[model samples]
Target: MKSLTQGAHHIGLTVADLEKSAAFFTELLGWNEVARNEQYPAVFVSDGTVMLTLWAVKQEPSVAFDRKSNIGLHHVAIRVPEDSALDQIHQKLLAHGVEVEFAPEPLNGGPMRHMMCYEPSGIRLEFIWPGE
Candidate 1:
């Protein structure tokens, strides 16, 4: 039998506002908006490597994110080129008024550095630098 799955093609997120969420990923993460469909109310952004699809929820009740209680996605962890990048992103997130879950710190003790924050749609995002 052959394996049917390949690496992750994209991640789709349901957001309150498509434009805001699209801007958030583009401005902060340096992703590029590749496509948009007003009819489906979906926007696609790419980091030049992976694509993220943001879908606008219509007439649906909004719910707060609770990692402890929710059974679905916990957070999306993105890899950074260097440890210094984490610090840079920390400042950018702050400037954009995004909530930083915690300052960048060592994950367990060796060389992994990471920081956590929430996107505009209440989705948790993590940036990590494995080591130099």
Candidate 2:
């Protein structure tokens, strides 16, 4: 069996407001929209390479992120570039009162960096720099 079965197909994120959430990703992460709203209530976005699809959930369900109660998935990791950029984004997250799960850490030996945070509905998200 293939350990990873090729690369990630896509990432699905449930959000309160599809419009707002989609815009946030496009703005903050510079992800361009590849497809959107073909399903009436769902929005699909991409960065010309990776796809990020957002589903509008009427009532967001409890997630493991709330307390490791819900199971199956832990979080989604996002790749970034610079450590300083991660630190600055962390500051903005704090200002927004976004739930930050931990302090940023150096990844891939040292240069790469990462931080964990929760979306409004308690979905764990990891922002990282996947070093070469």
Candidate 3:
């Protein structure tokens, strides 16, 4: 079937701490804060190529997303230009006290290298570098 969409325009994520999550993209990753909505309490960030819309959770007792059972987003895998970037980001994540699932290593015995970790708001992120 012919697809209507060209590619991803943006991604919206529901986070427990909107400020911290926004800071993750802006402060840690050095992405720019494009816009914000006080009414919905959402922060929009962009890294020149990709944009993320972080929405704040309204109430408590919120359940965390389980990739094994949940029928939602499993994880967001971001690509880096160079292989060393994975290690660099891993170091930054560790220095900042972010939870690291694993260090940079061969991805499933493949040529690509990747590392996984949880951001401040408990969202799983994977950083991968395509070796060439």
What's the CA RMSD of model 3 in angstroms? 1.2
The RMSD of every model to the true structure, in order and in angstroms, is: 1.7, 3.3, 1.2
TM-score of 3: 0.94
- Clash count per candidate: 0, 1, 0
**Candidate with the greatest TM-score versus the true structure:** 3
Off by over 4 Å in 1: 1-4
Give candidate 3 misplaced runs (Cα > 4 Å).
Answer: none
- Clashing pairs for model 2 are 80-128
lDDT of 3 by residue, 1-132 (tens): 999888788999999999999998899888899999999999999989888999999889888999999899999988888998898899999999999999999987868999999988899999999887
Report the lDDT tens digits of candidate 1 across residue range 1-132. 988999789999888878888999898889999999889999999988779999998766877668899799999998898989999999999998999999899998949999999899888999999987
Q: How does residue 68 of candidate 2 score in lDDT?
A: 58
Against the hidden reference, what TM-scores do the models get?
A: 0.92, 0.73, 0.94
Give the Å error, residue 2, model 2: 6.5
lDDT of 3: 0.92
Q: In terms of lDDT, which candidate is strongest?
A: 3
- Tell me model 1's lDDT, rounded to 2 decimals: 0.90
Decreasing TM-score order of the candidates: 3, 1, 2
